[model samples]
Target: MILIANSEAWPGFSKSIECLRRGERAVDALVAGICEVEREAKVRSVGYGGWPNMLGRMEFDAGVMDGATRQVGAVGAVPDTLPVAALAREVMRRLPHVMLTGDGARRFATELGFPIDETLHPDSKRVWWERLQKELSPEALAAFPDIPLAPLSHAITDPERVRDNTVFLGRDSAGDLASVTSTSGWAWKYPGRLGDSPIPGAGYYADSRFGAAACTHTGEMTMRCGTARTIVLALRLGHSLRQAVDLAVEELKDLRDGFIGGVVIHAIDADQTHRVVSLNCEEPIHYWFWQEGMNEPEKRAAERV
Candidate 1:
């Protein structure tokens, strides 16, 4: 058994491993793990505590993949819902679709009797507003919600670029692999921005025969390169876990234009070999890792490539 996840998943690291031990499928166990993070208000980058968009509204994105069948489901730009990761899993289980967005996703949530959470934590909203007030010009601030966001889009992103979105991957004793990505997305983003978190083969991909992979931060570049899928394909073609991750990072380096930022990848291969690597990241990245015999997951720095 093996589990690899970003630091944001620290709150629920043991829950995931225990789920695997309880005889849950990889996908189910991972979903359970991430749901813990989503429920946390202090995290501030996922679920209830997620930062609001420019309009001061909270929207979330989530994706889940089942490696055995390569079946996937994702929801993007959703609002008034907590833990959309579970909804994504349900989409994979119940619907014929691979992705759902906006009202469609909300309607599905309603069908499932999910409660609405439009009232985001006041601190998250206040911080978003304060930052926007500081960044926007007097005229832009005067225009406010009535203003066209496109003109101010360039000024509204989170200045720190702190992407704490959750990406969790696990390999069970049954040789099953699964991946899940859940995020509030880029802080102060345009209302409908859908990052790679909800896009399969970009933010996440899994195939039990080969391995599973997921990404965090810098979703735009990952979407363009299909980073997660590319890593799994490398493993399928007989590359070691390290080699596969190296190739993915090389692909990121090849990009000369478009949104370029740091990316941290978490992956586990069929033989339970796991790796975490960062690309173009200014700061060192750390992730959690655990195998069957370990009493607790280890926190270690990612290899910066």
Candidate 2:
């Protein structure tokens, strides 16, 4: 078995590894790790405590891909819910649809008895207010939730928020690979803005026969390029892991227009060989890695080209 996840997933990756050690299903193990990040108020990149949308709502996005089946389940722009990654897995198991969003997603969780997590960390809310107060005029602040936010969305930016998401990719003992992507998305984004986290073939793609790939942060670039699927296709077409990753980076570099930023890719081949690379990112990236026979996951720096 092999497992690799972005650094933000550190909080709960151990549980995921443990599940794999005990021979649990690959998707289950991936969810086990991501749920830990989702439920923590401190992670601030995904799940409960993450920064909210322009209106101060904790809207979440998450997705799961089962490599053996090529089936996907995802939720986007959901509000008042926790354990979003787990709910996405449930969408795969119970529903025929590949994705759900907004009120529909919330309703599905309710039908299955997922609890409403009314708790957005107080500090997160405070920080959001502080930023809003600085960006919006007193009249705009007074108008608050009643005002149109999409116009202001681009105006109020959180430089760090766009660069955060929890990405996990794993292959189990049975040769089944899986991936989970979870995030609160860009802070102060327009209401109902859905990034790449919930989109299959863009943010995440898995194929037990070929390989699995996941990307974080820059969803816009990946969405247009279908980056995760591109990496897997490159691997399936006989590209080496390094070559496939670089190809994806080259594609990103080709995009000379539109919103663009850094992206981190985590990938693993059918033989359990893994690679991580960052593109146009200001800082180095690190991720957790472990393969069969390893006692613990290693924290390694991602390659930058």
lDDT of candidate 2?
A: 0.89
For model 1 the local lDDT of residue 274 reads 87
Residue-by-residue lDDT tens digits, candidate 1, 4-89? 89988877788999999888998999999999999888777888878888898888999999999999999999888887999999
Model 2, range 1-305, lDDT digits (tens) per residue?
99999998989989999999999989999999899999887787888768888778889999999999999999999888888999999999999998999999999999999988884778878888888888888998898878777778678877465557899999998999998999998888888888889999999999999999999988989999999999999999999988988899899999999998899989998988899998888987899998889988899999887
Candidate 2 TM-score, C-alpha based:
0.97
* Residue 177 accuracy (lDDT) in model 1: 92
Q: Give me the displacement of residue 273 in model 2, in angstroms.
A: 1.1
- What Cα-based lDDT does every candidate model obtain? 0.89, 0.89
Error of 2 at 150 (Å): 3.0
After superposition, the stretches of candidate 2 with alpha carbons farther than 4 Å from their true spots are none
Q: Would you estimate the TM-scores of all the predictions?
A: 0.96, 0.97
